[model samples]
Target: MALTTGQHSWWRPLAGTALVLMATAVMTVMLASGTEIAGELANRPLDSEGTATWGDIGDTALALLSIAFAIPAVLLAAHCVQHRPMGTVSSVESRLRWRWLAICLALALPLVLFTVAVQALMPAPAGKSGDLAWAGTPAFLTGLATVWLLVPFQAAAEEYAFRGWLLQAVGAWCRSPWMAITPQALLFATAHGWGTVWGFTDLVVFGVVTGWLTIRTGGLEAAIALHILNNLVSMSIATAFAGAFASDDTAADMDWAAVAIDVPMVLLYATAVLWVTRRRERANGTDVPGGPNTSPPPPTPQTAAASRPTGYMDPAAEA
Candidate 1:
């Protein structure tokens, strides 16, 4: 179980590079197929507006697929190669509890309310010209359901890989909690890319908050819950504003001010969730049973020395 020296610095970056390359290959294949399909099905040449819509949908699909398959597959392969046990991948069983669910909801509510309040304060963005004649259509519902199922899975997979497996691996290797956490947060943010200044900023802050939760709780479950909640909230808001904002350009119409206000609320909720869970752990005597509140005592010099081998030599023989 001992971490090898230099493993911390090298293992994560190498794994991440492999994952990214695999995802790139998968996306390339998907895109080439899509291109062939589009060429064959060109019933009518898409206008500039249609092209924008196509791009948005294509990008979303590709991103979801990359996270859903590519990253998790790579991490699982790495875990197998390292001979690391499956138990170390995530701490869900330790952290998942009804009380924690209550706390997560309590934390999410204020942020949701704040987002609503801010949206109320701002004028609705200009509406897209076309009727979403597709709004209540069965096809729309089917597509939406498909997206809901697939998108959450994609998000969860990322949380498992980055916050779960990678976090634990790095923590073990570095022998420092913060060293494991900082890199995960940075990588999480960078993965979102700098598509828009506001969105990128939001993701960076979100990454820090989630990373803190992972480190504080010694698990990915809480962070995963928070991430899923955040994404669901954002998606719901986007759906509501779909008609009000240009459908093809929703990112440009994002309520950055609202997002900024909601971010603090998420942090507050995360802290409250951690505090409540920790308190419960102490009350139930689970802290001693390896819950979040438990901290192992520092290694003493004698203890360290005891772990090393000792050798005896005869003085007369040496002479």
Candidate 2:
């Protein structure tokens, strides 16, 4: 939101958005091409997919890294066009709040695990094989290793682009938070590519929820945590189930049943995170922005005092 608060011409955000798109495209292509060249030289043949899939370590890593290019692209656009610190795209605090991010990650793990359990208990879609086999130990280990290493950055790149960059870009022109939030949510859903109507709606809901959480928390940490965990779990499951990744199914392909489960899981996470943030603010005696659920905890008293101008005296102390 601070990106929107600065004094600049109206065209700045528009220009920044344009730069982001161009930069993302160029960077992704170059990165993907580089990966392919490296793969060829290594005799591995890494072909980047149009969409992210879990077929193999090479393909999976390519998909993630291709998308991950958005981070530097967005950051560059923010700095060059908006004249703001790259970190401001991360949070109103101008940098990642590691403690808050960790808290959200902790809150997300159980809920995601519970969702996976529920999915496991549910019947498989009709006509789709319910049977699953172990991907051989070596392949499985390699897949898992790739996921753990790249999925977090891949997921964070998305949050940085959507909830972080796009949201703030829109915010720069629009005074209303929803005005900023809605466009990015819709765009996020669209980026996943359309499948079933239910799945599309579900993706939209995910965007909206995560976008709102980004605003509520005054940072992308909440959204990023949820996304990273969701991708990690989903990809891990696919890796565990032999041949599952060969199929082209994505979140966009989810049926109503999947949507029903996913929608509520994200909502629950958002609610619980909000509660935790509120509790943190209260415990720290920090000013809560917006309302009870708002974020980027205000400076502590000692921090506040230390930040005051030289020789400045506190009126309360003088009294």
Candidate 3:
């Protein structure tokens, strides 16, 4: 089906969501079946010294499947690109001033460092060392590369589907900024149900910040860039710690106390982002939709006529 323009109706968003869910289901089945096949194949003898691990094969299959899951989102983004650019996309380079980027990174750095420090303070679990010795192995490295590529694609797809397209679509319908952001944030959080409960909570909070960024900036690129950077940093830190602290029997235990410190740091970073962006908008005289600067212009004569019908024929009949 052809994609719709703007938020004229609910059908487009519903259709897009249906497409995403169907694609997800198809990818899930493919991965499950491929995993079973890989498991059977792994049992066979090989000429090489080491046999393939089912875990490695499964990871590879899942990575490939993730790309498949992103197909619908990619199509939807293409559709948006063709129809009209979201105001946010147009403002990317201008709004994402170097100063703001630096502030965001600076803010994020302290939170991440504090998180790591708190983990250090926590008592080490018996047999738990967060090390990635396995990562150095040839097989594992190959699998890791595959996962790295696919994981970002998955994250991008989800953000595009929800934050990018859905936000625009809903805003068009409700004609209110809050209506657009609220449900999308809820949906974004709900989508993370498979993650740890705390992880889901973190995503919801992150979603709010990211959604606001999209709204404030008038484009998805800023939010997308930030989201990607955040994930890349998070994964890198986690992997490094996991490799360094790997134990014979257990994974490294997370320091929850550090998380307590990190949360406030993220809020501070978000505040900085808002300040930088709002300043830019004001300087440029750009109309920030739904913001305080937004005011209805005086009605033109044509607008007044359009509202009121003439005696001879209905305005609708004239059209």
lDDT of 1 by residue, 1-319 (tens): 1132122345654564466457647765776577557755864345454532333334455556656764455445445444433333444332334455455656766666666567666655455233433334443444455466666667677776667655655655444555666777677766665545665666666666776676555455566676666655555444432242234442223446655765776677777767776677677555311444445465475553222111101112223
TM-score of each: 0.65, 0.84, 0.61
Question: Candidate 1, after superposition: displacement of residue 22 in Å?
Answer: 2.7
TM-score, prediction 3: 0.61
Which candidate leads in lDDT? 2
List RMSD in Å for every model shown: 9.7, 7.3, 9.9
Instruction: Look at candidate 1 and give me any clashing residue pairs.
Output: none
* 1 or 3, greater by TM-score: 1
Candidate 2's TM-score reads 0.84
Q: Kindly report which residue stretches of model 2 are placed more than 4 angstroms away from their true locations once superposed.
A: 1-7, 39-55, 288-319
**Candidate order by TM-score, highest to lowest?**
2, 1, 3
How many residue pairs clash in each candidate at the backbone level?
A: 0, 0, 15
The worst-scoring run of ten residues by lDDT in candidate 3 lies at: 307-316
Best by TM-score: 2
Which is the better candidate, 1 or 2, if ranked by TM-score? 2
* Order of the predicted models by lDDT, top scorer first: 2, 1, 3
Q: Model 3 over residues 173-285: C-alpha lDDT tens digits?
A: 55345666778777887755543455555666667777767666544544555554554454444343323222221111223443455456557667766776667657655
After superposition, the stretches of candidate 3 with alpha carbons farther than 4 Å from their true spots are 1-7, 27-68, 71-74, 77-144, 194-199, 238-259, 282-319
RMSD of 2: 7.3
